[model samples]
Target: MTENKNNRTITWIVGGILILLLAGVSVLLISEKKVNKELTQEFELEKEDLENQYTTFARQYDELKLTVSNDSLSSLLEQEQLKTQRLLEELRTVKSSNAREIRRLRNELATLRKVMISYINQIDSLNRLTAQQKEIIADVTQKYNAASATINNLSQEKKALNQKVTLAAQLDATAIEVTPLNKRNKRTKRTKNIVQLKIDFVISKNITAQTGEKTLYVRITKPDNDVLTKNDADVFAYENRNLRYSIKKYIEYTGEEQPVTVYWDVEEFLYAGTYRIDIFTDGNLIGSQNFSLN
Candidate 1:
């Protein structure tokens, strides 16, 4: 009977030890499960943060493309943007438990960020250079305009001075006289008794006048305002037009006061009225006179 009691005690101890061991195993399993849950939460948070960074990086690349002007640089930015998008898609597809892939994408994101910063700095430098070039062009244009204006003003002044010099160099005629003469060279007053007309003038002394040969033209108009010319083709230029003259004479000018005389034979019928005489030289009317005969 005692032996039977000892065997029951041993059986109880073995049963208690098994019960405690099972309880310890249950506790260990619960703790391990809690730890696994916490680790999973951490991985999910990390993946979400990485996704946010990748998405933001892609958006920033698009923004950078807009600020770039160089065609090659813009194309490069577009390529980088596509790469960022591809990486973002990969990240989205990756399981939260994939720590290795998540870490790799995070490294790529860092590299992309550094590249974006470099592009931004380059774009800024290019913009500054463009601004400086514009300023220089504006300055040069302004100076060119000023120079053109000055040249125009100087040309106008030169033209005006040349015109004044031309005017000062022209000859002046004075003391003009016209007389009706008979066939005997005596002055007459009656229109029927006159057979010739005498014209006389004096060129005033001018140091500026050209000293050379000159041609003189005399035009006589009757009371009818008809010019008397021996030939219709006896013409001279005046004010860009041809004018018929009654008499032409040639003389040598010496830049000193000189007297000149020209005669016209009265071949046409004379009338009883006023007559006018004009003398021209060098395309300019130098003297004029009026007379009357009965």
Candidate 2:
């Protein structure tokens, strides 16, 4: 009976040891699951931070394009942007806790940052050179303008001296007289007795004027400001348009004081008012006079 009791005690001790072993294994499994959850959470956080950094780097690349102007540099920047986008797509597809892919992307980001810094330095150098060239061009242009102005001033002075010499060489007329002749070829003051008009003038001598056959035109303006012309087609250039003349005469000008006479026949009705006469030669109004009749 004592031996039977000892055997029962040994059996109970073996059962208790088995139960304790199972409990220990259960506790170990639960603790292992908790540790695995913590490691996954840490990896997930690290992945999220890496993604955020990639996004920030992309934004910086976009901003950098705005600061540059060179076409070649801009193209390079576009290529870099494409590379960054491709890497970001790859990062998105990779699992958050994939340590290998994450580390590769991080290294790429570092390399891209170095490349961006190099491009920035190159762009700055190009901009500074362009500024220096602009300054040099401005200085050269200022000197050219100053020289051009001096040449223009000298040309104007030369033109002015030539004009003074031309003016001193112009001809003149003096001792002008007009006579309204009657039907019997005698001067008359009555409008009804006038049949024609005679104009007499003396050309003053000018040694500077050329000796040649000269044509002179006489413009007769009536009281109503009407010019009496033999024909409507009889016109000469005055300012910029044709002007009607009453009569024209030719003379052999010998640079001496010589008398000249020209006649105009009356074909239109006359009025008892003041009349004006102007004589032109070589595009110059050398003489002007006025007369009145009853």
What TM-scores do the predictions have?
0.76, 0.66
Model 1 alpha-carbon miss at residue 81, Å:
3.3
For candidate 2, list the clashing residue pairs, or say none: none
Model 2, range 1-294, lDDT digits (tens) per residue?
A: 999999999999999999999999999999999998898898788778877877887787788889788888889988988888888888888886688888898899889889888988887898898889899999989999998898898889888877876665666767778899999999998888889889898888988787899988989999999999989998888888889999989999998888999898987889998999898888878888898878
Q: Once superposed on the true structure, which residue ranges of model 1 sit more than 4 Å away at CA?
A: 1-68, 184-194, 221-226, 270-279, 284-294
Give lDDT for model 2.
0.87
Please give, for residues 39-155, the per-residue lDDT of candidate 1 as tens digits.
999999999999898888888887888877899999988998999999999999999998899889889989988998898898899889988989999999999999999999999
Tell me the RMSD of model 1 versus the true structure: 3.8
Q: Worst 10-residue stretch by lDDT in candidate 2?
A: 164-173
What TM-score does model 2 achieve against the real structure? 0.66
The lDDT per prediction is 0.90, 0.87
